[model samples]
Each structure stands twice: as structure tokens, then as C-alpha cells.
Target: MPTLAINNFNIFCATLGGFITLFGLVSYLFKEKYYLSEALISLIAGLIFSPHATNWIRPQEYALNDIEILDTITLYFTRLVLGVQLVLAGVQLPSKYLKKEWKSLSFLIGPGMTTMWIVTSLLVFALVPHISFLHALAVGACVTPTDPVLSNSIVKGKFADKNIPKELQKIIIAESGTNDGLGYPFLFLPLYLIQHIGHQGQGSDNSTRVAMGLWFGEMWAYTILLSIVYGAAVGWVAKKLLHWAEERKYVDRESFLVFAITLALFIVGTVGMIGSDDVLACFIAGNTFTWDDWFRLETMDDSFQPTIDMLLNVSVFIWFGAVAPWWLFAHSPVIPIWRLIVLGILVLLLRRLPIIFALHKKIHQIEEARQAVFVGFFGPIGVSAIFYLYVSHEFLNGITVDGEIREDAAYLKEVMEVVIWFLVICSVIVHGLCIPMAKLGFFIPRTLTTALDSLGRTGSDSSDDPQPAFQQAQAGESETTDAEDRLRRRPGWSRTGGDSLPTRVFRIGRSLMRSGTSSADANRAPGQAPLPVSSVPTIIDSGDGDGEGDASAKVDGKSDGSEVSTGGGGAAPSAPALGEDVISGRTIRFHDEQQQQRTEEAKVGQKV
Candidate 1:
């Protein structure tokens, strides 16, 4: 017999690696891909073929005898995965969009989410009379946060047809990043309600109200706002410490982010232990970190967040499938099948329409009503929801109101659970299916779309033409710049900020070098500052329609390298420059007069 070698962790690693590898194969095998979404693939695979190496029972009863391990899995993995993602999402969002479209974003994530939660709560109460109202509301709030993983899978798939509006997609991504954190208050409301309900029957009004105030008011309200404040504090604090450490030669320039990432994790753990919500804190932290847009870039955009999210998300999804009681459909003799179907449909349907209609009246940045409707409906519950679902399970399992255990506690827990599982299945399927039909038309009325368009200012998608705005500038052009601006792109200095693989890494490194770089390593010369690659050289447009003008060159040079450095410019990952390592996309170009003077006047359109 072939020797079998695997443990729980190893099985998990194998599943994650194997699924990811298979996804790559599927994607490459069929260039014209349709059904190879990573999230979808993982979910299906988990359902069919997980190792079940842990406490999970073979038949998929979905029982929680080993709640501790499951909770650990959900808590630790979700925090690490979702925490970093939330932060990256916030940091990487273009500041211009935040400023220009704050109103629209607010409408999308704020009132839109609240309205959906409220509607779902109402529907749950109306349809499933047996489930407690507060419990239903908790699930409502739980489901309110949209899953970007699912939405992105669809938008990125062949089904999107490149017609999925960019602005709309951005709004969805931004809103999903936030709504999970924001929606937690409602989720907690139910648990608190469950605690209070039995106590209220005991008729200790003063005590109950005080307990409610402590949990709901102080813990819930004050904690969320404080987490936001704490988040802002972390960003500025990290930067200050980073500067201090670098200036003191305590850390290497290349390892600067080690300090920042450590600070983030510390802040998260400390905040959570202190009784404030850490998820909200971390999300806000990401948004607040590197308030400057230039510093907000992810070092390796292709490999960083995408890779982390995929591994963590895919593992969780598959594990969820492995543990998911798809058998619930069969064992759910407690709730009628028709009711479950109706509840699931109502949960999904109630998500979009109301929010879009309400938001259209005030959000000027929204290009169309149908577009808003499309986004509102696209609110699929994902990692965060999964985290909360397990949390809800933990919160609801066992324990009766007062000392006397409610006989129906088991039934109530399962009933509430049935709704959640149904929602997950419905969301994955419906949202996934709807991707193909996205281009057909919006569900909103044409008259409503026209009215919203007339009432609100019209918006256009960003230009699709490949040439970047900087390249549009005339060469040798020197213009007055704001004293506070740090942009390196001026005449004579062409900024190819997209140098090498990690723009964030290089950008930050370049900034530190300019600020007096000091390496901690003893082998290297102590205070060597690495000079930045000047902007990419382009034909100087002489402000003429014929592209024949040169603006005055304002050279802002910062170099400890009086010894001229050659081959300085950085390369974009997809767009390699001439004379560069193709695999790494690294390049060498002149940034200063010392090096530039020797540079030949290379012909235009020549590679490198």
C-alpha cells in the first residue's frame, strides 16, 4: 500500500496549493475561459473533495462539537487575511476618488447597506415568524456586507465582456471593503438582544438598560468610532516610528515595511484585547495609512494582495465547502423547503433595489440609476460574512435566556443557520449567474434612469486610451508646481514610477534615499543614499499642436551619488523598457546631468 503522509496543516496547505495550481492550469488551458473563477472552483472542490483531517465528521452533519478549532480557524485566518486586505484596499484607493466621489461612496456603503439590512430584517420577521426578530436582524446585518471576492470573480470573468462599468466596479470594490466593518454593529445588536431578551422578562429594567447601554452604546457605538480614531493614529504613528528607526540606523531601508506591518498587527491585537472592535479598526487603519496617495501603492500589485486573498480566501471557501452541510437541504425537515427558498430569494432581492433608488437622489457621481441598482444587487456575502456566520454560531450555540435552558434553543439555532446557509448558496449562485447577464440591461426602469440622469450631473468613464496622462505632457516642459507636491514628473525628469515589480517598495525606497538613506549592514558604506531614476524621457512637446514644444526644464536632483549611476529608470511589470531584465522588468537609465549628458539621443519608438 502506498504510504500516506499528511497532517491537518499539511492537508490545508495541499488544498490551497493544489487548487491554486489547478486554477492556473484551467485558466491557461482555455484562453477563452468562462467557468474557471478561483473562488467558484475552490468552493466546488471543497464541497466534493476536502481531506477532512480535523474534527469534521465524514457525513457532513455540520455539527459543532469542536467549535473551538473551527472558531480558531475562522478567527485567526480571517483576521490575518481580511485584516491585511482591508488595510491594503483602503491605502491603495486613489485619494482623488475619495475627494471627488466621497458623496457617492458614502451613499453606496452607508445608507445603501443600512437600507438593505433593514429590509432583510423585515422580510425575515415577516416570512419566518418562528425566528426571533432580533436574531433575524443580526443575520440581516451579517448579510449586509458585500463580498468583493464573488463580485470581482464575476466582473473579471469572460462574462463581464469589458463592458462592466469601471466607475461602478470601483464603487463596488470600495464599498465592499468598508461595508463589512461598518455592518458589524448590527451583527452585535442581535447577540446583545439575545442576552437582554431573557433578562427583560426577568423585569430588571434598570439593570437591563445599563447592561444594554454598556454593550450596545459604549462597546458598540463608542468602540466603532474609537476604532476609526485608533486607525488614524496607527498610520501617522507608524510613519513617525519608521522615520525615527531609519534616521537612527535601527532598520535597513529595504526592510522598512517590516516595521510598518508589525505596527499594524500589534495595533490590531492590542485594540481587540482592549475591547474595541479590531476589524473596524484595521479597516480604518488601512484607509488612513499613508494618507498620501503616492505612498499608498501595493509593492507587488500582481502578487501581493491577490495572492494573499486567494490563498486565504480559497482555503476558507474550500474548508467551508468541506464542512458545509450541503446535507442541510435534506436534513432540514424542521423548516419547509418552500419557506427556505422564499427566504433565500427575499434575502437576495431585498439587497439592491431599495438602496439604489434611495441613493440616486443625492449621489451626483453616480452615472446612471441602473448602474447603482446593479451594484446594490451585487452585494454577495463572502469572507467577512463567513467570519461573522461562525461568530453567530458561536454566539447562538447553547445557553438559554436565564438559567432555564429554552427547549427550542437547538431548533432556533438551526433555523437561523438554515437561512444563513441558504443565503450563502443563493448568493454564490445568483451573483455568479448574473455576471453573464450584466451587459443585457439593468433591472431599473428606463424612465427612472432618465430621471436620475437629468436630475443628477452625468458622469463619463475614464479614458480607455493606453497613453498615460504624464506622457501627454510636452517634453522639456517645466511648469510651476505646488510647493507641497512631491511628484517627480517635470520637464527633463520623466517619472517612470512603475519601475521593477514592486512600485510601493521602489517608491518608498526612492523617498527614503532622497531623505538620506543609511543601511544598517556593516559590509556596505554606512550612509549611502540610493538615487532615484529620473522620469522617462519623451519628446519634448513645445506647447504646439504639432507636438514640437519644450517647456523649461526644472531639474530637482537629490543624489549622494556625485559618482554618476548608470541605468536608473524603473520598469512597469507588464510594460518592460529597453535594455532591461525581461523577467524582473528592471532597467537602467540616466536621472541626472552627469549621466544624462553621456546618454545618446536615442530614436523615438526604439525599445529600451
Candidate 2:
């Protein structure tokens, strides 16, 4: 076959691979249970067959050479696709949304990083003993950053409960977004030390300190701070440009200019100047530019957002499939069978357990706890992991002159490749499988429980009376009446005009309701109120006779009177009968007297 035909064939394979993977993912979106599995299968199959297909079409001598032609082709496609997808991801993120959900994001960081560190440490100590502590730290750093692409794909939005705090969702998304790039420094620093630490000595120490300082200070902190500032500045400028364009009726021209300028500044300028990992700069720039005004522009369509995202997704995944080192599966010496198994188990446990423990106190529900666990465990090592290996190998290879450091370089390269490859493969499989299972396990139950609880609460609160009225026949001693009155006067039931009688009835009936309800429900009954007997009203028919009776009648007649009158009335008011208003439908009551008592009690409680 001709070379042109072979190249065309390889391109065709790439396109086909892209199509299959995307189709499966799209199908998964539509609730197809097997879609993810099918997608994974298709992905694996394409990875295996696409190269052979390309080879058959164009049998070149150097096709499978050191750097596979197939790999290079895929990598370029991946970068192109990822770039577009990343932009869309940025566009979709509204600044207001992030700000509102900042708390959840903050809460997640501690647990997430802790999990990464602990697991990485344990794994390095246990499995790869030959590797230094620094190397383990490097591995921890590499794996620490969550892969937004993988996490976003696996954590199905539809499965999540709507009531689940938005903060939780934002935390998950934001962590995934920022961490991928963050892990790069961690991955690079250790490898750098491993290679140069001994030879460079004091000078190396200084350089290392400088690099570390830069890594923490400039690249991490300064870059993030400046990106926000620059992005905001650019956004402000874009807003002004947009206003000018609108005033001049040059809206279309203005929009096009805005996009072009933003694309150049964010994607091209930042990456070109600072290096490829400057994704945060691009994100902040896009974020700042799209702030409130640009979104208001009539000509600026949101349709472009999804299209860009899809293109990026296709590119990133295809490249991932294409360039994946099949040789690592067959022959990386650094990651032997024991190491692979140990690392895999350690990574999963370390990544998840700490998050579970950390979040358990804050998240009350069991399902949320389970979700925290699942999300924690399934953090698949992704693009950053591979990127780390690539840079490390390149650096190490550059250092080796002749055979002097070749062994060490080769060993480091092998270790990086094997470990990364294992993670990638395991993530694709484990997370892919767990995604569906997690949906079935945690998300579904949590959603169902929330729905049921909400319905029950709504039903209880919407009833007539909202608290039960005591029966007239049940009127007894004043103490009994006082107890019942106290129950009625409890703060559990609000006396707003909007409240229905049935709701009150339900509140009161709860105490008399049959046993077998949960203890929590029983404790919530309105009858648990504590009020003085003197604060309760005693109901008397006109025939009940005695000076106390007249006084009680007068007290009952008073609109705001809640306490029993105790002046020198006949028979000392006869100790006020209990259940005085048991069945009196005309009676409406509140805790006016009890409230004063409660204030005093509260003050006492506070002092105590």
C-alpha cells in the first residue's frame, strides 16, 4: 500500500476509535446500563486493533519505532481535543456558582489531600521498597490531583440526589479541575532529586530549594493569584469592549473579536510562554472574560460551549487510547506483579478512607457517607500521571551521558511507566465498574430516602389542627390540665394563621399515637413541653358555682389571659381541674405565660 493510503488509514482508525468511544459515553448518558462497559470494551479493542489496522494500511519500517507513529498521531489529536474540552469546561463554570459553593470545596481539600498522601506513603513503603521515600512522595504527589475528565465521566450527575449540598458537588468538580496540574510538581520534584541529588551536592541543594520555592511560591501560589487577577482584568476589558460594540451596533464583530482575543490570550499566550501546564491561567482568563457581561451579549451563543467540550473529550480520550504503552503491560520490570497489586489496593484504600472519616462528622446521612467513600476510592490517576512519567523520562534520559547514568535513567523510566500504566488501566476498569455500582448503591438509596422523608414531613405539616385538641371528658385535676396545656403551649407548633388545625391535631395525636414508631419520632412529640400548673386554664360551665368559678370564667374570657387567677377567690380556685378544655373546640391557646417562664429557665440554664 502507498504511504498516503497508510496515513489516511491511520487517521481513519483514529476517527473510528473516537466515534465508538463517544457513542458509548453518549449512550451511558441516556441510561444505557451497558454503555460504559461497552465503551470500555470498545476503547480497549480500538487500542489493540487501531495500530494493527494502520500498520496493515501503511507498513512503514519505523511505524513501531521507539516512539510509535500511532502514539504521536494520537497525542497530537488528544492535545487538540483536550484543549477545546477544557475551554468548554471553563465556560460552563459560572463564577457565581463557584462562589456560592465554595464551602463544600474547602471542606473537601483537607480530606482529599490527606488521603492522597497517606496512601502514597503506605504504598511506596510496602510495594516499591527499592524506591526512596522521596520517590514515594513523588508518587503521592502525582496521584494526589484528581482527573476531572475521568471523575466527571464516572460520577453521573443524574444519579446524585438533588438535595445533596451543592458545595459537595462543587468541591468534587473544583478539586478535579485544579489538582491534575497541581500533581505535576510533586511528580517532577522527586524524580529530579533522585537523578541529580548526589552529584549536584550543595549547588543542587540550592537549586532544589529555588525550584521548590518557585514550585510552591510562584508556580502554585503566584500563578493562581495572578491568573485570577489577570483573568478578572481581561474579563473587565472584554465587558467594556462588549459594551462599546453594543453601543455602536457592532455586536457580531465585537463577539468574534472577544473570542479570538480570549483564545489567543488564554490558550496560546499562557501555554506558549509559561509551559503547557498553564491550564489554570487559561481557565481563569476564560472565566474572567465570560463574567456577567459577555454572557449578556445577544450574539454570543452558548451552543458553542458544548461543541468545544465534545471536541476536546474526543481528542483527549482518543489520544489516551492511542498512546497508551502496550509494552508496559508486557514488559516493565519496575512494576512486578506484587508491586502492581499492592499499589492498586493501596491507592484505592488510601485515597478513600481518610475522606470517609473526615466527612462522616459533617454529613449525617449514611448514603452521603457511602458516596464520600466511593468518590474517595475511585480517584483514577489520569493525564497528569502520564505527563509526569513523560517529563521524568525525558529529563533522566537527557542527564545520562554514555552508560554512566543509563541504568539509573532506565530504571526510573521503567518505574514511572509501569506505575502510571498500572494506574491508568486500573482506573479505567475499576472506576468504570464502580461508577454504575455506586449509582446503584449510594445515590439511588439516598435519593429515595430523601424523597420519602420529604413527603412524610410535608404530609405531617399540612394537616388540620396540626395539634390534637384534648377531649372535654378528659378534664381532670388542674395539674393534669396544666400538663395538657403545657403540651399545647409547646414551641414545636407555630401559631401562624397559615397553620391548619389538622397539623395541630397531628402534633398532639403523636403523643397518643400507637407505639412502634421510631424513638426519634416519639421524642419529637409536642406533649413533651414543661409548663406550670398555674399557667393552665380551667374550663367551667355557668353552673359550676363559687367565687373561684367566677374568677376562672373571667380569666378564661380574657383574650390574652393564660395563667390561672389566684386572688382571694372562692375555694382557692379548687386546685384547677385537669383536662378542663379536653374537647372544647372553641378554645385556641398559646404559651404566653409559659414563654415568660421559659425565658427565666433559659437564663438559669445559661448561667448554669
> Whose TM-score is greatest here?
1
The true-versus-predicted C-alpha distance at residue 251 of model 2, in Å, is 4.5
lDDT of 2 by residue, 348-396 (tens): 6666667656665554332466667655675666654554555555566
Q: Model 2's lDDT to the true fold?
A: 0.50
Off-target runs (Cα >4 Å) in candidate 1 are 1-10, 28-32, 51-65, 96-101, 154-161, 164-166, 199-208, 242-264, 298-302, 397-411, 437-608
Per-prediction backbone clash count:
18, 34
List model 1 lDDT by residue over 522-589, tens digit each: 11233864434333222211122221122221112211112212244543112212223333443533
In model 2, which range of ten residues has the least summed lDDT? 543-552
Determine the C-alpha RMSD for candidate 1 after optimal superposition of all C-alphas.
17.3
